[model samples]
Target: MRSAHHPATGDLSLPEVMAALSDPLRIGLLRVLADGGERGWGELRAPVAKSTLSHHLRVLRDAGVTRTRQEGTRCFVTLRRDDLESRFPGLVAAVLAAAEADGVGGGVRLASDAA
Candidate 1:
């Protein structure tokens, strides 16, 4: 088990969050976590390389968009819905909503998924 560094809600910055979500693949992974439960990396459906996925997770964590917990050799990630809602006030929902409109998480990969 290991602890992943995550920015506190109050420490979240809009630019950082935007940079984190700018990638379509990260947005797709966020959609998976948006379901409001802890999801293992294997369950994320990211289809990205291990290194790429780790980079995305780190971005989200640093931006205070997600929280990760490690148990044994597995890592579980969850969206910080309430924190985001309180700090950014509907930002998370709005982004997910926009992603939905763009076909995110519908098993269709956006172009940036190739990154």
Candidate 2:
């Protein structure tokens, strides 16, 4: 199996992670994965089209916010919890907490928002 080009855990950059999470769609994905488990792309219930979804995933992967792996015909995505915690400590938790505190939830339209 060819290993993907994920950054070394220790080398995960703050700016890249911020850029990845700055998008609402990606933030929603991260919120779903906040509980610490892998989620197949099919399991996510976002309203975006498949292509937009793929773009969001690629941005997250490239920014080292998530790890994606192919399981035969299926692809699963998960937050890099350990890596993020190790490098930035409670940053992920804080972000999610703030989102919750702000009452963010489902039904937010991503496609309607111009990025």
Top model number, TM-score: 2
- Candidate 1 lDDT, tens digit per residue, 1-115? 3578888889888898889889887888778777687877766545667788788888888888899888889887888989888888888889999999988655523233443
Query: TM-scores of all models?
Result: 0.84, 0.85
- Taking all chains together, the TM-score of candidate 1 against the true structure is 0.84
- Model 2 over residues 6-94: C-alpha lDDT tens digits? 88898899999999888777788878788788888777767778889888988989888899988887888888999999999999999
Alpha-carbon deviation at 91 in model 2, angstroms: 0.4
Stretches off by above 4 angstroms in model 1 are 105-115
* Model 2 residue 98 distance off true place after TM-score fit, in angstroms: 0.8
Per-structure clash totals for the candidates:
0, 0
Candidates in order have lDDT scores of: 0.79, 0.80
List residue ranges in candidate 2 displaced over 4 A.
1-3, 108-115
Candidate whose lDDT is highest = 2
Model 1, residue 88: distance off in Å is 0.6
Q: What's the CA error at residue 32 for candidate 2, in Å?
A: 0.2
lDDT of 2 at 13: 90
